[model samples]
Structure formats: structure tokens, C-alpha cells
Target: MGRSREKEDAESRFNSPVSISVADSSVSLLKLISILIIFVVGVVIGLVSSSHIDRYFSFRADQFNIKNIYFAADQFSSDSEKMLVNCERECALSMESFIRPLNLNHRMTDDELFWRASMVPQKEEFPFKRVPKVAFMFMTRGPLPMMPLWDRFFSGQDVDKYSIYVHALPGFELNVSNSSVFYRRQIPSQHVEWGSVSLVDGEKRLLANALLDFSNERFVLLSESCIPIYNFQTVYKYLTRSVHSFVESYDNPSRYGRGRYNRRMKPDIRLTDWRKGSQWFEIHRTLAIKIVADTKYYKLFKKYCHPSCYPDEHYIPTYLHKFYGALNANRTVTYVDWSLMGPHPATFTAVNITEGFLQSLRNNGTLCSYNTEKTSVCYLFARKFDSSALEPLLNISSQVLGF
Candidate 1:
């Protein structure tokens, strides 16, 4: 009976739908707790990783925005620089066109020319580097026959120390090489008649042109017939060092002096104020500017001083005596022989260009003050040399003249 009852209990227990023991229940609870903990840990890790990823993408986006901004600024700056370059180029072209014209034939009137030349710097010192230069102004009727001799005289000299200006007849061009010093040195010219107001006009025109160059501190007037009696260095040193201008001015009672004075120049000019001089002159820049700026005196001479009056001979002398007498040395550096007793000076020919004759002229038995000391070296240049004398002069230029 006992065995049968135990078997029934076991069967009933098996049939009673999976009744669990205490140990089994404990194992199931532990597995459930572990699964819940693992799920919570996974959720927290996902939240933290997602936040880190978002921050990394945000930083990269900011870096890309900054690069785009810098690129745009660089493009704008490049465009601005190009525009500035174009503007500067255009301004430079405009300025160049205004300052320098294409043609050499400047057709400006004398009134305009003088007005332009008279414009001087008001300051005591010049704005630019000022190396004083001597201006040799040549007023010629036609082509220069003595250019070869002059070329030799000027060769190998410092170009900056001297300047050349030629005022030939209108429409005339000097046929010189580009390498020649006189090349392209011709200023605009007018028709100049001998012994007329036009002659004075031509001289003033040369002065006005020379005055345009601020570096020209001394001005010497010359003609095609004129020749330097000494070497260039000697002439330059003598002229530049002298305190007084070498303008041959003197008061004479003869008809050539006071007789040439016209009463029509009444209060402005008088016989007592009249004087005579050689036309060739070497004046300082101060006197040069004064000559160019003169209007009243020039007009009076133009109207009254005719052929017999000889404006070239009397006007500048009278003008200087009346105004700037102290500035002149009262003599000429250029030697002219009036011993032949004619209306004009003696015309030297080839035969006259001897070594002895030149030597006499150089030490012409006359005493004149040079830089306040009396000296026998009176003459620096001689004039009215015939074109035929050029060869003889050239022959003696090196040895006797020491040029």
C-alpha cells in the first residue's frame, strides 16, 4: 500500500503543471536582475556616444565655415588691388600727356613764353638737387658753320656742367647727330632782322628759353661767328667765379651812344641815361630773369629804337646802367676790333686767325678787373669770324688755344 501511495504522489506532482523548487526560483530571479542591469547600461552608453558624435560634427562644420569666409575675403582683396593698379596707370598716362607734347615745334606766343619762363620758385632753396650749369645761347641766322670747332671744344667735357641752346631761323633744324651735344637743342624761333628790334627780341627769346632750366645759373649770348678764345674749363671757371656780369656797358658822348637816344622815350629814357655796349653778354641768373620779366623797358625800346638807334647796342647797356649797374663788370669778355672804324666790327678771315694775332687778343695789352683783381687776360672769346677762318681756327685751336 505504501509503495502504491508514493507512486500516486509522484504522478500527481508531475501532472500538477510544473511546480518549481525554491532553488530554481532563486536562479530565475538572478538571471532577470542581470538582464535589466545590462539593458540600463546599454541605454546610458548610447546616449553618451551620440552626444560625442554630434560635438565632433559641429566642430568640423565651424571649421568649414571659417575657410569659406577667408576665401571670399581673399577674392575681394584681389579685385580691389587690380582696380587700384588700373586707376594708377590711367592717372600716370594722363599726367604724362599734359606735361610733354609730341611735337618739337612749340607754337606758343612770346607773351605766353615769357609768362611761363618768369615762374620761379618762391622758396629760398630749390626743391630738387641744384647743380649749377652755364647756358651757352647761340642766336644764329642759319646753319652753324663752326660746329666742328665747337664739337672739339665740347668733347670729353662733363655734360652736366654746361648746356647749349640754339635759336636759329624759324623752320630751320640743326643737322647734328644724336650723339652731338647740340642735337635737338633748338628752341622755337622767329625771324630776326639785323640792327632791328627783332634782334633784341631774339636775344630775349633765348634768355627766356634758358631761364626755363632751373639748373642754368649763368647765361652767355653768342652768335654763329663767335669762337671761344680759351679752353672750356678756363672760360667756365672765369665766368662762374666772377661776381659781376660781363656786359660791355659804357657812357659815351658820341652819336653811336647818346645820339642814338630818341626823345620819344622821354620820361622813361633820357639822353643822360643813354649808353652803348656790345650785344654779346654773360649775365647771371638774376639779371637773366630781370631781362625776361621786363615789359615796360622792352616796349619803349621796341617803339623808339630803330636802325640808327641800334637797340642791341644801346638798349641793354642803358637798361643795365639805369637798373642793375652794380651787377655788371662794365666790360665784355668777347673781344671785337673796332680799330678798322666802320659801322660794324672787323670781320676776321682765315689769314687773321694766326697764332700771334690770337695771342695778342688773348693778352690784349689791356688791363681789366677779373674777380676784383686787375689782369691782362681780358678776352675769353672773339667774334665776327668768317666761315673761311674755321679751318685755320681749328688748326690752332689745340696748341695755341689749349682747347
Candidate 2:
């Protein structure tokens, strides 16, 4: 009891002095809190030094300029809009191309189709991005007697470079299988006779049919008897690159020329302006359009030209000679042995199917002005071949025609 009372008295003397160890610990605690405060302030200053660009604005802290943030936005939007428009345009063109071949089987819209087939842009303008093609148009009376020869000629060629059209006599059935080059190529045709307006009409129909395809750049008129003298490539190069059309045009003072002219065609087609040319012709797209577009002269020929007048002989020559004389080569690419015939040219039989005769036709000794001046290599096709020449032509096709 005495010891416990002595300890309580000592503690009551706490007011006199504090312990050294307790005082030192309190001072250490104060120093630690001061260091923490400095570190927190330093961190805040570092973050503020790396702030967003919005801080640079002078007037207000929250306000920012859109012109600075969206500088490239307008440009990006314009480019995206252009891309979208281009894609839409291209899609529309592709759709139209898919629908064109289907239109051929529909009813004849000959009058509404005239302007489309015949109207063309100026000489300097060409809008077809597609590769240009050659349209081989055959104005046959009926079945093609020399189709085998033609099949071989057209075989194994690039499908993109050429197209075929046959204006056969209505109801004339051909044995052409679906695999043939001429398969299903027959257009809606009417009856045609020699030396008549119907012949011209037939050729016009071919032009209109071929013109439906915008890619066709050159149009060739062929009869069933006609055979290509050169390979497709040679003929293609000769015609496709030709600046002037190859229609045998000349000033025929003979009874066949101006003699066939109707004086009623005075202001439209004067006798002096009248001309003569072969019916078989190779014309460019421009001339082909002009032919189809010719209501005035075609009317004149239909009214005036007779079998003796021979519209087939004088109509094309006179019209082309009037407007586009200088552009005409004044020659034909098709070879006809007119030396042996009356009104019609001589037809070739198996006897004339020798390699030497064909080679001579290809390299005739005569020179005619082609795309440029006269060249040694002239004829690309020949006409008036009989059906019997088919076998011989096929036999020598590989060795001679180079198909």
C-alpha cells in the first residue's frame, strides 16, 4: 500500500517536466508532414505544364476555335463525296451495258432509233472508254453459202475486237449451230433485191443494228460470197487505224453515174455533185451514221433510182463524194473481178481456189491509196465466191488465210 501511494505521487509531478524521447518523436512527425505537402504541390505544377491546346486561348478558358480543330475536315469530306459520286456513275454504266443485248429481241423501234444510230459527236470527240470494235455486217440474200470459210476466218480471234451481224432474207433458215461465230446474229430483216432501194435499206439496217453497240468503230459490209483476203489482225489494223473510209468513189462520166441522177434532187444532190461508188464498202463510224441519217438523199434515190438507174451503184458514191470527198481513199478494200462480168461480178468456183490466185488477190500488182498514199498490200477481202469454193477454202485456210 505504501509503494502504490509513492508511484502515484511521482506521476502527479508530470506538470514539472516532459520525457525527452516523447518530445523527439513529436518533432519527427511534424517534419514528415511538411515533406508530403511539398511533393503534392510539385506534382500539380508538372501536370499543368503539359496541358491541351485549349489553354492557349486568351479570352476564355472553356472556349476553343473550330477552325483550328477541323482544318482538314472539309477537305476530307469533299474527297469522300467525290469517291461516292464516281462509284454511283460507274455502277449506272455497268447496268446499262448489261441491258443492251437484251433490247435487240424487242419490237422494232426503227424511227425512234434513227437519231441514236446516226447522230454522232464532232470529229474531235470520242467518249467510248471501251476498246473499239469492228462490226462485220453481211447483207446476204439467204443462207451464207461460204459460211464455213467465214467461220474459219473469224475463228480463234479475240472476242473483244470484232462482232458479226447478218441481214439475211426473212425466213431464210441457216444451219449455223449455236457454237458458230455467226450464231444467233441474224437481225430483224426484210426482203431485198439487187439494184433496188431495198439493198440500200438493208445496209442501213445493218448500220443501225451495229450502232446500238457504242464500241463499234468500223463497219464492214459483206455479202455471203465475200471472203477475207488477209488475217483478222491485218484487216483490223488497216481499217481501224484508217483516217479515211475505203469506198471506191470516182467521177463516173458513164451512163451509170449522172445518168442515174434525178434532176428533182437539184438543191440537195446536183448532177455535177453526183458520184459513183461500189455497193460493197468499208466505212468508219462517222460515215456509217451519215448513211443512216440520210433521209433527203435516200428519198431522192428511192424516188429516182431504178434497176437501170442502179441506186446501189450511185447512191453511196454520190452522197459521200459530195460531203466527204477528200476523206475518201477513192478505192475499195474488197477485190472484185469485174473484168469478167456484165452487170454482176464473176463468181469464183473451186477452180479459182488455188493458193496462188488468193495470194495474187492479196498482193495485187496495182497500188491503191489506203490510210495514207498507195501501198503494195491492198485487198483485205474478195467477193463473188461460189458455195463450191468452201471445201477448198477450208483446206487451204491454215496455210493461206492465216486464221
> Residues 1-403, candidate 1, lDDT per residue (tens digit)?
9999999999998966655566678899999999999999999999999999999999999999988866665566565455444545675556333323222345579998888777767788765566788999999988898888888889999887788989999888898998888887888999999889999999999988877777788999999999988998998898888899989889888777788788999898887888899999999999988888899999999998888788998878889999999999999888888988998899999988899998998986889898889999888888889999999999988999987
Q: Estimate each model's TM-score.
A: 0.74, 0.73
* Candidate 2 residue-wise lDDT, 63-82, digit = tens: 44555434545455565455
In candidate 2, residue 344 scores what lDDT? 84
Pairs that collide in candidate 2 are: none
Residue 48: error of model 2 in Å?
71
- Winning model by TM-score: 1
Q: Residue 382 error for model 1, in Å?
A: 0.4
Give per-residue lDDT, candidate 2, residue 43: 85
